[model samples]
Target: MTEPEGSEPAQDLSDQDIFAVLDSDHRALLELADRAATTGGADELAVHCEQLVMLAVRHFVAEEQYLFPLMRQHLPDGDRSVHRLSDAHRHLESELRRLEDVERSPQAVGPILADVRARLVDHVESLSQAFASLRGEIDPAEAQRLGDDVLGVEQLAPTRPRLDHSDSPALNKLVSLVEGYVDRIRDAYTHRGVERDER
Candidate 1:
């Protein structure tokens, strides 16, 4: 996984601590989506929408690679719980893709972003409850390790959502790597989430 320049390692963080990252990111994305929905100017809307989507991409990937699997392994009726959460993620991604397509159209984008925000809120609540349950069951040392892994994987996660993915671990890793590389290249070229003034 690629690390940001001058970044320090995750310092003895527990799984509960890792959930803080998710909470912060969840707030950021919802705030961005809210801005996208309310902003009048198309350019401003596009900027917020792109940022929301990028944040969601990384957050979702980190959870899928680390948090969700832990839930499936540790929580009661874990498989079914994870399936519901994963399906919610897929639906959110689909809505985000639509938001991307109509980014320049304020009327169309507003409703889509609103829907995305609602879905995100619901998903976050569900995941939070699952994690709370898992926290009591999982070992402290293992949770710490998973926390570090979640942070590490997020740095290398794709900045764009990919719909066509398999459940196979090997294939998922390969797809994540390839997509992350391509998305980084595209973001570099287009300055995807960079503010217009900075660009």
Candidate 2:
């Protein structure tokens, strides 16, 4: 059966379910940050960080504009927490911009990523705690509406997400590189019986 298009649909997450996505990413980012901190970063570390910045910028924009308001209606304290998260987004944007500016040197990338990583860690911690406290206050249905809005966002990670051998080996190589990360994340968080359905 096809899943529901909204949050209430099969595997569609309620507020906590939506937060779980962010929480998972939060942990992944920490692992990436840890690697960057301990060993010198691999060449693609910066590239991956840029991808993360883009992903997060999109995710946060959608969340703040749509998701948080749902919570605000249900929970009186949500407005304040949302504001705090907005401030965190501003800070994160600044850090992302800084990361974007330094292209060549790992030296330049490391310290800035470290700073941003620290802030993200703290932001996730604070948001998690606050949201947990207020989760009981949110209506499941409204949260689903907010999640549906996220599903309706009008962009893709790639305009043409298809994979073909029509181009250079570079394209296939890049796909594999990303799939590797996906594999790690799935192994870390998903069960063994899960299927990989790119479509």
Candidate 3:
């Protein structure tokens, strides 16, 4: 399958299927989690957690926007799996938010970060398997197209969680647009997700 005309190639992510793209993101997140765990200072740990949270917000939005809906339509047990995974996503978001809020106190944040890491590990594994099954059920070209879409949307996705937003596609898209804009502003002012070099 060919990429859309005039769309910039997505680094090494071009031509990957949705599963591959998400797996790449999952690896990055897990590595960041490990780094955050090893950090000596509370402030450094807080920065790492902020970065993790921002990455996760992009990752989850990509999944909800493309992955879950595809699962529901393609996999035999997809509907049930989506429901369970959706719940898990909410729980993971809450854990990340807690980690973000308490990062100033490393003692308090350590356990939370650990929980987030564990949950993320399981979540990524589940998605990998589910999407593998899904990939088998769908066309290769369509899968690549969805992967390209995920990469595209993530560029405009929110940098923070909006716990109040529902999972419906149309509504979620609208919310994401607004939240993405607001989050960009907030991240700019607070430097929530900007790396030290960028700030």
Candidate 4:
């Protein structure tokens, strides 16, 4: 796991494995996003938007349900980012609503759509990087096991992404996004699992 140059967390989470998985999903997201961005008409746009939004909604469900609060509890102002991420999710939700309203392949919401995309992308990148910093602080074995415990979110991936992938920065980030989301989700689920098993 790479460390943030400085201002590193006292601990870091295991991200390499998550990044690998998400990188693949990110590719699929990009493919869908690209289609949405370049659609010849609103009908096509709606179809593409549906694909993107559904995937994002499922992803948002897992992240908000499991990850951010854990980080906030552990790191300085780490919890602050949790709210930021949640706010970003709201932005996604609003955009999804807008997409749903496009009855005639509407063309007026480009600027609004663009802003939503920018906010969401920034949220994903920053959170992953923050997690990377935290990853640096923990024991190697702890980190690896932590990663496994949290990986249940992948098993919960809304739908499987295409099996094969090619290179792209956009896709890479998406992959990281998936990995990060699951890592956190798994963490939450793991805690819950332990509680259940104990009971």
CA shift at 190, candidate 2, in angstroms? 32
**TM-score of candidate 1 to 2 decimals:** 0.86
Q: Supply the global lDDT for candidate 4.
A: 0.51
Write one digit per residue (lDDT tens) for candidate 1, span 1-199: 2212123443333344556556656766766676777778777778778888888888888777777677777877888987787788889999989888873787788678779989988987887787688778877777767767666776677888787756554666678888988898999899997778888
Q: Which structure among the candidates has the greatest TM-score?
A: 3
Residue-level lDDT of model 3, residues 38-149, one tens digit each, is 7787657777788888888888888888998999998889889988988888898888878766736667877988899999989988887787788788888988998899
* Cα lDDT, model 4, residue 180: 51
Worst 10 residues of 2 by lDDT: 154-163
Better of 1 and 4 by TM-score: 1
Q: By TM-score, rank the candidates, best first.
A: 3, 1, 2, 4
Question: Model 4, range 55-134, lDDT digits (tens) per residue?
Answer: 56545544444345346656677767776766666666776666556553545546545665675667557667766766
Over 4 Å off in model 1, which ranges?
1-16
- Quote each prediction's TM-score: 0.86, 0.60, 0.90, 0.57
Off by over 4 Å in 2: 1-16, 35-42, 151-199
Query: If both were scored by TM-score, which would come out higher, candidate 1 or candidate 2?
Result: 1
The per-model lDDT (C-alpha) reads: 0.74, 0.52, 0.80, 0.51
In terms of TM-score, how similar is model 3 to the real structure? 0.90
- Per-residue lDDT of model 2, residues 120-151, tens digit only: 78877886765675557656665555455454
Candidate 2 residue-wise lDDT at 155: 27
